[model samples]
Target: SAGLYDEARRGWLYPMDVNPAGQNAFKKDAWNKYRIECIGSSIRTWLNGIPCTNLVDNLVSSGFIALQVHSIGKNDTPGKQIRWRNIRIQTSNVKPSKADNIFVVNMIPNDLSAQEKKEGFSLLWDGKTTNGWIGAYKDTFPAKGWNIANGELSVDKAAGGESTNGGDIVTVKEYGPFELKFDFKLTEGANSGVKYFVTLSEGNKGSAIGMEYQILDDLRHPDAKLGKDGNRTLGSLYDLIASKKIANSTRPIGEWNRGFIRVNKNNKIEYFLNGIKVTEFTRGTPEFNALVAASKYKDWKGFGMAPKGHILLQDHGDRVSFRSIKIKEL
Candidate 1:
């Protein structure tokens, strides 16, 4: 058993629970009851009778239940304790009534919820397969240099170079007006990006040309210092428009950060990090074309002119991972 904090910060769950443990919505150090109920495909859980997890899964129709206490370090409090009582069950097909106030966190990965599906959302990556991706410079998925495991798609670490080693990957399908959401994690000084409106016709070398949502450790990466006025910092439209100096809520390194990129039919593009709007620019506008004219991509014919293009995951030869990749067509 290792420390739980490291895994919990990355949204890992305990063996017996649908959601992460130690949430402590109830008063700390106070006695709290955890109620777990299963009704066919639906498994609901409560902390102190306050609903917390609502999961629908049939794969785990049965299993053993066990209590886990992660191993602690030598400097830890010697007598760290956990207490539980009233460990009883009713197999008579009964469940506690749902409370309307408490939020129910769905911990199941990549599966669309009823509400999400009704709202016209679909899983873009499906969390476990590379069925929708291909190398930006090639027609098939790369034979090597990328990894898909445990529901995460990641680029392997190599010599720090832009699309030089592993190359870049793109969605097989193109997008026009869409809303994309995903979770990303960064290694120290890692430089990667999520790009859209990508046309493989750009060139045979280097990263694909697109409007990039820069993913970076701005303070640690040298690119943060080289770009014009932080234009290449995280959340910016890489190398062209600087992300606004707004309040951004980013998790620490090794933890997951949510990314949101929305493009309306009008080409109003927005980039958000952890639900905070960090950058926005309308493509095809005079100001946009002007900025592109001065940026590094000016030489590429028809840059940012593609009406519809694929979404790309940059392989900058640095370790970066993406998960929960999803998109909603607008």
Candidate 2:
């Protein structure tokens, strides 16, 4: 059984529930041998050749045994690895039974609560503390850069720089293919963008390392005037490709606008605004290659080619607000 902290920090397994039998035999970057015996609703464990006293919920009747290899390292040792062996299981003549449907709740809010929850959809933001989120540079939340006021996460303009005080704010967790929904409100004559496939390093400085979903007041910003025709407009994949559909769906200066981004397992990316599909791009295609070549990221190899990365909220020195940030992994 691998816990959430174990998966995030040590990287052995995916985030799941766990019940330890002994006095918490797991440690970061350190191994401990365990001997355990299971009976009816009880599992006795010995940690490192020492018998210990601990109790766990015996919800499992019978199951197969498994061994896991984990990766654990800090920024200094980026590619550390772990291993395990000598795994065996003892079973009686009893057969395993299936349990009933159990719902796993998410953190964010949504409209289709009943149906989404039944289908395993989750909310990413709870409109409160930034529990599952952190600044892209530092270990804690941004002090003067972002604020959750009046049920919305607003970007503070006065605290603006390139990763100086606080850079972008990303989810503490990462994702693969998923449908992300959020609402944003932008200031007039300001520029910003939301990016994905974001990998952090002591290397790259700006947003050009990953693919960015263009978020700007296209009608007023200077960047919207720089690209070919209107290629850099709002919802047009920044400066590379242009969105086909165009509607005046953006609310004025202080009003909120709904935005949705969906990425499938086949690497198909779709962008929607105000319930209209504005852009569709298939990654790793010849057309995508051509677009990347013509764009500013021509020199970079495999710029947006990662299957998974961090979700980033940008700070372009503008007053931007976001709410209802939720995602459903496919």
Candidate 3:
């Protein structure tokens, strides 16, 4: 049996109840067999040749068999644990097959697949070079602010000042209603953001001009506390909204984090981190209006009110890298 706790700590996999100091115990009878197998998306568990349960979940497809020994206690008088045996697992040995040449022949390089094409999507960064992107300021692209290293578009900190040398970059073509997907990796303590509905002027600078999809380290960044309450944390709308969930399910620093932003023609915005939707908001809604009214964006008329605008990558002066940047117009 698993111990239960009232609240679970971040990144811990055990169920809530297992006391940190109590001696939680589990024992398996001798000659008893526990078979766990995956049939499609369901996991079937049989204990002692008797079916116990079938769990259906899309979260994980497969994993290793584990027998846990839990004990509760801090330093001296903690709880104890147990032992488990006769454990076995059955797994599919066949790897998922790749598409054949016939199906691959129709695929375009650095372009949307047929399914995505049908949805009116396209590639923003043409895997090989930066053709449709330019520095945020002036007309010429920044020579040193960005680099294509090992297929990733990486920002070098020493190359320039925050938004001074490299500035922010935007798509050459403006989009009104669409969905965007990309992979990003951030250095520890680095700061950056993705902004949309961006309007550039001679004097105006910074992401305050439009709406921002904040990219930051929630656990370490000070900006996480700069906004009203905790609304300014990573994945929230900078200062106006809060992400429903923070996906700690990120790869370590320097590893890529998949992100998705969907803005519909009707002004609905959805944010996803690593394939898990963390937040959703409808623009122009009364509830959204209330949030804006109560937030730092109260005075701005077009705060998040644009019908269409350009997509921008923020240059917060830290080393942030992006790759597999693609988009689909919805």
Q: lDDT of each structure? A: 0.75, 0.64, 0.63
Q: Could you tell me how far off, in angstroms, the CA of residue 148 lies in candidate 2 after the best superposition?
A: 1.3
lDDT of 1 by residue, 126-166 (tens): 78878988898797888877999998899999998888876
Error of 1 at 174 (Å): 0.9
Off by over 4 Å in 2: 1-112, 159-165
Candidate structures ordered by lDDT, highest first: 1, 2, 3
- Lowest lDDT sum, 10 consecutive residues, model 1, at 11-20
Winner on lDDT between 2 and 3 is: 2
TM-score of 1: 0.69
Residue 296, model 2: Cα distance from true site in angstroms: 1.7
Residue 164 C-alpha lDDT in model 1: 80
Q: Which candidate leads in lDDT? A: 1
Q: Model 1: clashing residue pairs?
A: none
lDDT per residue (tens digit) for residues 1-330 in model 2: 222121232221112211223235555676767666655543444556544422222335677654555444456566556566566666676432222122222223333344345555566777777878887756787776778877788777754344443467888787889888777888877666777777664256644256777778877777888877677777778777776644344556676666778889999998766434678899899999998999888877787888788888887777788887878888
